[model samples]
Target: MHESLFSYINQNAASPLTSDEEALIMASFQPKKYRKKQYFLQEGDVCKYVGFIVKGAMRQYSVDDKGAEHIVNLFLENWWVSDRESAVMLTPSRYNIDTWEDTELLVATVADMVDLIGKIPLFGQMTRLMDQRSFIASQRRLNSTISNTADKRYEEFADNHPKFIQRFPQHIIASYLGITKDTLSRVRKQAMKK
Candidate 1:
């Protein structure tokens, strides 16, 4: 339940929250559910809400001109996901975020977030930390994409996420790695035989 979210908040918060503060913060969030493959945000639509996953998995991706899908990121339980640019600027999103499995989420509209920040300073601090971590992850992904070979990238991904290969479909992982499914298969096979 939402106690999971409170636990996550405690772990990331600048300091422990008072009961009143926790209640105020929690009031802004609404629980939502999506069936497997449901779209949370689709390309060309404005992102209306940012979600914290309570359970299940999701993927953020875009389809290229050639119709190939490129995964931007994968989100699992306890993770937060949003099309930040669209959410902040009120612009159409270029990416799509969809459920990979039936998902339960705690969602906050931008207005709710604004209210929470104004009412609870701890929420503001938590959001700042979230933003910083997101930026660092983006930088690391960019570096790996530009400087690493396919094999090296796969190795790093596999090393960092030892269980993802088992949890998600291979094609999804291949798309995330910026590699072809066949290439991923070959690399994994080679890795196994080593």
Candidate 2:
């Protein structure tokens, strides 16, 4: 479980972490399991844990005033998911995070993470890079949503998250892309013909 998570972090982090540091990170980590459709973070609740995915997929979303769901993200194996702002701020969350399937997560509390980061310099650098990537990706997604056609949005989304095309349900994927299921189907059909 730790292997895949650490491998992903090490590969993606700006500075590589040593084996000793990795071992230290594993020391304070706790494992948790979620049943299919279980909530990790719920709207109006505080998000206290940051998780590394060991198995299965999770979706981060929120319900609108009209009760339509908007998916913010899909996390799979080796992915990290949490209400970063809420967890860091210790405030109520506006988003909801839940399992798409039975999922196993390696959880580290914010306090534990703070301690680990202060002790491990590599961890801080790594987290900074990851946060930067997250910010950039969010901006790009926003741009895509506002400026591009639905088909273009789906096409680029498929290009970036190749695995999600197969991993997520079509309706869920369409929700994430801010389009109807029929639009997603047409976009996919058009994409395949290209």
Candidate 3:
């Protein structure tokens, strides 16, 4: 069950971890499962765990004042999903994280993370890299939303996450790209012609 997690850790680590270190890391995580549409974190609740997706898909989103949902990102296999600020600060999260499909996750609490970092120093480095990469990705997404045309945004999102285009429904993809469903359909048709 932890095979995917172990491989992901080893592949992303600066150097190979010893068997004992791998065991220690694995021991720190606990498994959880969510059925489709089940929530891992909800708005106004403190996010207590950082989850690594073992299978299926999850989405991070927020409801606006008008009661509409805006998708922030989709979390897929081998990805980490969390309201980072809330998880780290023990504050209530503004976002809700829920499964798009039945999902298996290996999750760690902040205390568990702290213990792992203290015991396995290399994990600290790996986490730093993870944070940096997450920040860069967030920046790119924000830039795309602000500066690109809807069609351009859809195209970039499709190119960057082709797997998501295939995995998620059109409406979900439209929300993630901050476009209307009609606009997404139009964009897809236009792309096909080009």
For model 3, the run of ten residues with the poorest summed lDDT: 8-17
How would you order the candidates by TM-score, starting with the best? 3, 1, 2
lDDT of 2: 0.88
**For each candidate, what is the lDDT?**
0.90, 0.88, 0.89
Candidate 3 residues lying further than 4 Å off, grouped into runs, are none
Stretches of model 1 off by over 4 angstroms after superposition:
none
Residue-level lDDT of model 3, residues 1-194, one tens digit each, is 67888787778787877889878877888889899999999999998788899999999999999998999889899999889889888889999999999999999887888888888877887788888998998899999999999989988888889999889999999999989999999999999999
User: What root-mean-square deviation over C-alphas does model 1 reach?
Assistant: 1.2
Clashing pairs in 1: none
Q: Which residue ranges in model 2 land beyond 4 Å of their true spot? A: 13-20
- Give the C-alpha miss distance for residue 122 in model 1, angstroms: 1.7
Candidate 2 vs candidate 3: the TM-score winner is 3
Local accuracy of candidate 2 as per-residue lDDT tens digits, 1-194: 78876777778666677888888888867888999999988998988888999999999998999999999899998888899889888899999999998999999988888888798887777778788989999999999999999988988988899989888999999999999999999988998898
